[model samples]
Target: MSFLPPWVGLLLALLLFGALAAWVLRRGLARQAANLAQVVTGEDVQAQAHRRIQQQHLADLDRALTEGRLNANQHAAARDELMRQVLLDQAQAGTALQRGGDGVTGPVRWGWIVLLLGALSGLSYLQLGAQQTWWPVPLSQRVQISATSPEQLAEQTRVWQQATQNRPDDAEAWLTLARLQAAQNAHAQAEQALARVLALSPEPDLWIERAQMKALSAGGVYTGEPWQWIENVLREQPRHLNALVLAGSAAWSEKRHAAAQSYWQRALGLVPADSEAAQGLQQALAQAQAASPAAELAQGVAAPPSAAAPGTALAGDARPVIQGEVRLSPELQKHIVTGATLFVYALAEEGSRRPVAIWRSTPTSWPVRFALSDSMGMGAPPVLSSLAQVRLVARISQTGSAQKQAGDLQVELPGVKTGVQGVVLDITGR
Candidate 1:
């Protein structure tokens, strides 16, 4: 059953239901027909028996009169009595036949039976069947309402607003209303609904979401109350990924490149290396570094005391030696094209777009071992050995292009010290 597709299973179930219903209906109709036949046959049999008995009594009375055993008056009285009894019996049999005819012994109405069975089957299916299984569009995907008319959207918004009002304590209702309002760009109303949701739920993620709504309402500026909410969340859960990302964006908006880098770096370490969120954060970090290289270098030189953490870069002499093993996820193994280019590189900083040392090759097997040193530097001065720490990246490019493209598998290992060994970079995502 699990191997069958949803539609196939649904179809099989419907067919089986139809067959069973037909069988029951046919059997019932046949039984009713047989009962009707039996009622008619019984009436005929009773009439024949009454006729035979009356005929025998009349014949006996005539013979007795002829032989002088009974007189005419006596014979006439006896005949009348027998006839009266016959009429009573006939009357009782007629009543019984009438009752049978009025009940199940009557004619079977094919139209009514078909209609009843069909209706019952349909109702049962509606109650028991998986309704979405046969739908043309899958329900798993989010329904896109962007193409809806303005009037329709307004009607939907009104409905959701009424729902929230009716169920004031329902956090889900409030959250739904907030999302609807946000979709309509009604940021102010969305924020209000979100506030109600936060009051009811009070989860950290909800707080971050409300903070985002506030930022959107404030023209994409996370100042005032939005920034305060983010700060509060960070203070409580310093490693909260969403709060860190939001804080980084806020700092970037304020032209605080170093702070943004720090926040994003911490957030980056929390997510899978090949995830879209990590990629976006890495891109943002690169832009921040490019915008203020001097700040990045200064921050690198005088590292904060907190930078000594496991994921953070440690202050040490630059040693240009990084060795790592790159592997593809089992599911992605079949996607590896023949003669594909494999790029193993090291970034001078955690978020630098340009690679300081790069080693490119065509790999033919799994778990490719790689080593990067100062000699493989793309340029002098800012080589791998000149940096205290570097971020390692391994990519399998189908098109053999140096730039990342669609369908390219890649992975990253950030905050790797210069003399790192046995680093594993798994190309698990595209």
Candidate 2:
């Protein structure tokens, strides 16, 4: 009706179409049923009547051939056979019904069967599957895809280059291309990409990365960060290979030889000492050594925090370590050391009859057993998630040259132990 909404009219039309489909299906089923009834009753229908007319025409032709009144040699033979098949087919049809064939009781049409199946599937999905969650659909991928191999990496770099044509200022795209090219060991292409990254006029954070990339690569000193970027990285990750090499290069430029040696040594720890980068490090170390003894001493004396003060050791009484009965968590029994430096380490040997886990403390009853916490400058500590056996020893130094090792103690407990994880203060100042 004109009063109905457009949506209502669409629904009404769909309903009408559905009704027509049902009517057509019912009528086809009724016709099949009637034909099946005739087959069982042995009653001839229009089908059998058509077979009689065909047989009569064939008999007329055969009679003409038998009387030699017509040239029906090939034609009469075919007509005689055809009349005999018609009579046989009629007799069979009257006696028995065809099962699952083109006759009345044939299976439903494949097209209609497929349509019904699809509708049932959709209906079931809406009625049950859509209303209930039978299984969890995970939100994140469980397995991570690794970075591409060298061959694939080269192809991706070309795609990124083309994408940058439409978006010239896309810093992320350029950075990806640069890093990927570097991974593929395409140093020249990487240099070009890095150049574009620097040209984007990025912020200070980005500037550090750009500067590091430019100077760290073999393309030599990039104008990105002339003096500061590599130094900061060195200060944090002194053993970083690229960073160490850059620091050595910068120190050589300033004629600071021993600093170059230290940086090169640190770099050697991360990469082999005989690589091309190492060869450069050797040359710089030699040049810096020739011109930097006084400068090096001054620089060393300048950092009082790290350096042991001249003539003075720790400026105060060594902190005492108090150890008592250990408390076990549901899993572990750990010693509690409050207000003490936890010096975690490994014993040169585990089953010794002496101290294993050590803390930095002054009060020890001994021939001044000096324990240096050698864990400093070590890149990382063990993760807290696992159970591990740790060795510890405490030490106190009174004078710069005179050191006393007093209490070196060890503790063994359940591997899953939790306690204060701290570092010894540079008590050289204290």
Candidate 3:
């Protein structure tokens, strides 16, 4: 069975109503034509002819009485009868003229009826239908998973689970449901779903998804079993981007910076330079290099005497840095108007409101990157390096002030250590 386009259905409905209107109009016009023809060529003409005949008959009767061929009483009775017939014919003629005038005016009445039908139909559609929301849903876009709230995602997961249960051998269905479950943070259930897919068909993609779900279920710590699954995938398809990124994230979290660098670099080479994936991979590579043991050793080897000396500026220093991209949520962009400013800042986890460092930039199309280093400090002294843990904030200020207030859109990453990267903060709520 072939499905028609949505616009085709709407067009058909409009045509159907238009055809009905035309049929009604055609019926009304035909009825009026019949009435007009009846008045002109029917009873009215017949009645007028009858009246003339009656007058002639009376004249004949009078002549009969003049010529003495008929008696006076007979002529009188015949003239009286003829006069009554003439009066009746005149009444009928008047009625036919009145009916013909009504038929001539029928178009106005039918016109009102047609106009009323159209007006009512339009008003009903406006009130009850999504007249403003008509758009095409391409098959690709329909299949793509969207970011959803927890409640909505939970409902979707349930629906997908039911589908899989009904079709146990459906590998694609199981995989898709696993992806959805993972998106909703149901990591354990997602892992189980992926297991089912592997049981039915052990595909490389399913292996990669299994590794991802394991990593997520363990709070993004891609070590032990999760790392093994990722390594297994990489061995088969060395340049698989998903497996590489997952492996890189795991290695970076465990301080295995060299391995993280190698994996992310491979993944980076696979994407367009200006793509979002490339940007994310670059951030990860930068973080890995910053924390790499070889890089640190090289820095120590290149240090000057003052840099290594005790009681020097570098003696007690740990140059902690926090870097990330921030974006406004797609759903929350409508609240923003002109004069809005984005303030990305860091504050000590348990300390005062004074920021360790802050960066100010005007709002742009989002996923904008910002790096808050010790150099961005306000008034110097107790800088970002001094705070072991801090919270990073991305705020859209209505009044362009550091002070938070009602109606401001903001998001926070709490207890974030320095040297963190790829910390995407979505400013979704006040």
Candidate 4:
């Protein structure tokens, strides 16, 4: 059973329940059949006895009149009276036998049993099962609202809002409505729905969710009143993943790189290394590190000798792979602004100045390690994999331009062949 798919388990459970219900119905029907048999048997015996007694009474009346014990008028009157009495006695006996047969009780008892069974089944299912959700919705109508397009979600939000209005006390329904509203960027309305949920059942996750809604309403800002709610949840459950992610994003947006790093690093530890969430966090961490101030050790270091082996595969690429560290000179760092964009890339050793692979960073720290491989390759043709040799370049482009400009500080490592190691490019004040 544990190995079976969830839907299969559900199907088997439904079949079992149906069989039980059928057995119960069959048993009730059999009891009714037994009651019918009792009624038939008793009625048959009573009718036979009544018929025999009636015949005997007629005979006795005929014998008396024949023996000449009375005149015609008296005999006729007595015979009429005897016949009337006999018929009265038979009707009284039949009424008694019918009552004694317990015929009415059968249907009445069955009716009560049926009602009880129905009520019990309904109540049990409502209490223990998924309630309305327990029943399978038709496949065509069961589109998950979360996965729907923005337009579809907008329509769904209206429908869900109307439903929640009709069922004001339904906490789960309100929560669902809140999510749909938020998805459609109706943050204010979503917050109101979340308030209703909290009123019904105050939960930590709800608080965090409401805070997130508030943040979205403020155009991705995570500070002010909303942060209070988020902070409260974090205080209670420090390892809460959603709260951590929200906090990190908010900090990053605010340029509070250190705080963002703390929150995101914690979250990174909570997820699997290969998961998408982990990958996203890794990217975030890399950005955070780049935004940090360059370390002293990376200042003014000479480039490592080119270690490109003649037949060696690019760092790890089947073709050319260029791996190195890019750093701004300490003297240059004094002139550059904290958040200036840095572009580090590799180009063909000869030909047009188009890049094979590129990475952009805003460095707060120096000597940021970089790897250029096929995965990071851009544009059509002359890919990193096709290059036998390449030139690596790093540019601190205050204007965020790829082409060289007057104010840009640039450095290049030329004639570096594929599969090089310990290659370093340093930007200088020269």
Name model 3 segments beyond 4 Å from true.
1-143, 300-430
State every prediction's TM-score relative to the real structure: 0.36, 0.24, 0.39, 0.37
lDDT of each: 0.69, 0.44, 0.68, 0.66
Instruction: TM-score for candidate 3, please give it.
Output: 0.39
For model 1, the superposed segments whose C-alpha errors exceed 4 Å read 1-152, 293-430
lDDT of 3: 0.68
Tens digits of per-residue lDDT for model 3, 274-321: 996787677667656765776777677432132122111221122427
Prediction 4 TM-score vs. true: 0.37
Q: How would you encode candidate 2's per-residue C-alpha lDDT over 216-288 as one tens digit per residue?
A: 3422333345357665655665555655665665554343456667776676567566775555455444534
Clashing residue pairs in candidate 4, if any?
290-363, 290-364, 291-364, 292-364, 292-365, 293-364, 293-365, 294-365, 294-366, 314-321
Which segments of candidate 2 are over 4 A away from where they belong? 1-148, 199-209, 216-245, 252-255, 261-430
Q: Which 10-residue window in model 3 sums to the lowest lDDT?
A: 307-316
Provide C-alpha RMSD values for all models, in order: 19.9, 25.2, 18.9, 16.1
Highest lDDT against the true fold, candidate:
1
**Worst lDDT 10-window in candidate 4:** 303-312
Backbone clash numbers for all candidates listed: 0, 12, 0, 10
Q: Residue-wise lDDT of candidate 4 within 228-248, one digit each (tens)?
A: 887887898999887787777
User: Which TM-score value belongs to model 2?
Assistant: 0.24
Please identify model 4 stretches exceeding 4 Å from their true place: 1-147, 294-430
In the range 1-430, model 1's lDDT, one tens digit per residue, is: 1445555655676677677667766876677677667888988897898899899988999999999999999989998998898889889888887676556523345555566568757755754575654343421122234424447767888887899889999877777777667654456677898899878777777787778777655544677998899999999999998789878776765656678788888998999999867776776666556546585466575422321221112232213378777888778888888989887877656332335666777878887877776444422124566578887778888977654566888777778888778888988786
